[model samples]
Target chain A: MKYKDYYEILGVPRDADDDAIKKAYRKLAHKYHPDVSKDPAGEEKFKEIAEAYATLKDADKRAAYDRLGSHSPGQDFQPPPDWGTQYGEQDLRFEDIDLSDLLAGLAGGRQRGAGRRGTMAMPGEDYEVTARISLEDAYAGTLVDLNLSVPEYDANGRLHRVPRVFKARIPKGATHGQRLRLRGKGGKGFHGGRDGDLYLNIELVPHALFRPSGHDLYLDLPLAPWEAALGATVAVPTLAGTVHLKVPAGTAAGSKLRLSGRGLPTPHGKPGDLYAIAQIAVPPKLSEAERELFQKLAAGSTFDPRSHFNSEVKHGD
Target chain B: MATEPVEPAWLNDDARVSLDELAALSGLTDAALRELVDYGVLHPVDAAEAQWTFSARWVVVARTACRLRNDFELDLNALALTLSFLDRIRDLEAQLRSANAQLPRRHY
Candidate 1:
């Protein structure tokens, strides 16, 4: 029920050229395709990506969508009444030229029909479920038990609750709202056709120590002010465990330490590096003893960090 | 009173035919079994020239490979890679669990 920014979802700028949009969509589609991905929630994400590209890829539809301005697909959606009449009178048919049947693969086994129908067939129903993973479990990748709450209608026509337990694998680099599909896991197929897939959308809870990046891990390493200026050997956390890291001497603030082959491993066995970005922590309050020591140290040093500011200044002749 | 730890279901269960019996029963060629072994998904006890034995675990591994290839539509190389990672994760998890359990709990 949330409004998704199609351009942002496709990793494209709002003013991106049509060629750029197409290129981005194609590359992302190939990567997140359910058939190719081992991600537990890949199919639904593929559908969302397809839906985003479907509207944004067209010129007229993109214009209308842009004008709608931050509304969900069916939220108070009404087109201009005279617009269809104008097109009808102009002898122009908005045939399904823009929407190819290629999207059916993204929606999971939905087939194209023989008729010239304007709208696409109802997509296979998608089911949303949650998967929880520990930071290490997410980094190394592991199978998870997903408790799915499926709604079932009783003979009296009242909806009842039915819970199903499924085991799904969460691949490395999975992000929030990324979808995975289980074949024949959704509602029964219409007309005795194969059932739709069960879509698991990921929602990763916060970890006490580890954070996730795309095939990488992030963690905040608290460093002393002295450690930032005059470096020290520190123990840093990684997906495998904590490892000793060398903070190079004279390292400035915002410097990053790269620990090679210490992050999440890709399916192809290539691993990402752990990045330890430097953050100089300034104490909020200092005791009189500490303040005196700092004042003496400040007086002893003849260093001006902004010394280059005046040197770089250029005056008009 | 402290409660005893529960063992995993896989552990308490009977040592079903080690990968060797599975190979003899499955009638699959040695080449196919080698492929499964190379993927690191199936564990075999011994390897010899035309005399290697596989556990019944290979059947499950083979089925998983089949599902990954036929149903999920992954290529052989990708399927192999996915299974290899899954095995590595499982191994790491077991090690972590053992290490955590072995550490003495410090109660303040």
Candidate 2:
């Protein structure tokens, strides 16, 4: 079995008092606990921290661990043959067990002969998975197969992760940051306890062409200067398909053209609107003829875009 | 055998739960949930009803609060304040993310 230095995991000295170990555990627990932490690896980190503290906090378990002598973290080592007998646990084969397993068994040994009842009805643990989907999927309901390695005890009472696949049907209209609870979808309950739930926190991938705000979709529509100046019917893409949008003459850049009830479809109410924000596109390299025409239009035009920039407050004409 | 496909209910801002169900789901007593309602930590859909009915989402909130309370050994009085602050933080983070999403994801 590979040795895991409980002291190193908690960043404490081997001779550190219980108070120091507790302080370290509490501090790390507050930072990395799964429910409160936002860090991606917080749960894993908290598990290690919790396991380390679980051993070092107990007097008997800590002493048993101390007797194993020091070895580098993860170094392959086997306990002395007499080690099991010294701890009154001769049946446990150290080679097949983790350091955590050894320590945890010792903890259970300490609590033995205390009227330990059979398994109680404890609820299963809740599972939270962030499911990232596209804007198109949110428009239409889709199914996702979640392959999760769930921890469970083997026939020999050794902890192992059993692979399980669950098909989750995400309903339509799931927006970004939305949380959907799948009833009884988490870890199985112990004995006759109530099964836990699985929470799918929806994360919508940033769409290439569209930006979603709540149910509404926004996209920048590129329009040639002439098209903006002279009204035209242009085809715009929606989640379903393309639709013709009439851009009014004299439409300013950054102004929105609303496509009613074309955004996302919701079950509770009418669909949201799609907004096309106008953005005027100009040719980067102009031909000689185009340059001459542009120069003529600029020379003839009386529109002053910077007229308001000259005054602190504009006067109403 | 095929893994049974489970269809999840799309959660909305609506959906009511009575006090008894909320208490059972949250792993909290009815009186404690009522106390939370008094503190404005939770809002009931029907406050005047003999058994208050809350939005179903509050079950998650109350359970989260319970977890925090047990994990940190926080007192009941302090649980409401902590939950409110956490909710605000989550809201602010979500607001920031959506506001940032308003910009184009990829730039040419």
The candidate scoring highest on TM-score is 2
Candidate 1 - chain A - TM? 0.52
Worst 10 residues of 2 chain B by lDDT: B99-108
CAPRI quality level assigned to candidate 1 from its DockQ score: incorrect
Residue ranges of candidate 1 with Cα displaced over 4 Å: A1-134, A140-161, A171-178, A190-192, A208-210, A287-289, A313-317, B1-108
How well does chain B match by TM-score in each candidate? 0.55, 0.87
Determine which window of 10 residues in candidate 1 chain A has minimal summed lDDT.
A96-105
A84 Cα displacement, candidate 1 (Å): 37
The sequence of per-residue lDDT tens digits that candidate 2 reaches over residues A138-240 is 9998888787766555555544446788888888877876777888888666657777777788888888888887788888888888889898899999999
What lDDT would each prediction earn against the true structure? 0.56, 0.79
| Highest lDDT scorer | 2
DockQ of each model vs. true complex: 0.03, 0.52
List model 1 lDDT by residue over A42-141, tens digit each: 7777767777787777675576556536655333333344543432322222221122222222122123321222134332343545676665666666
* TM-score: model 2 vs. ground truth: 0.85
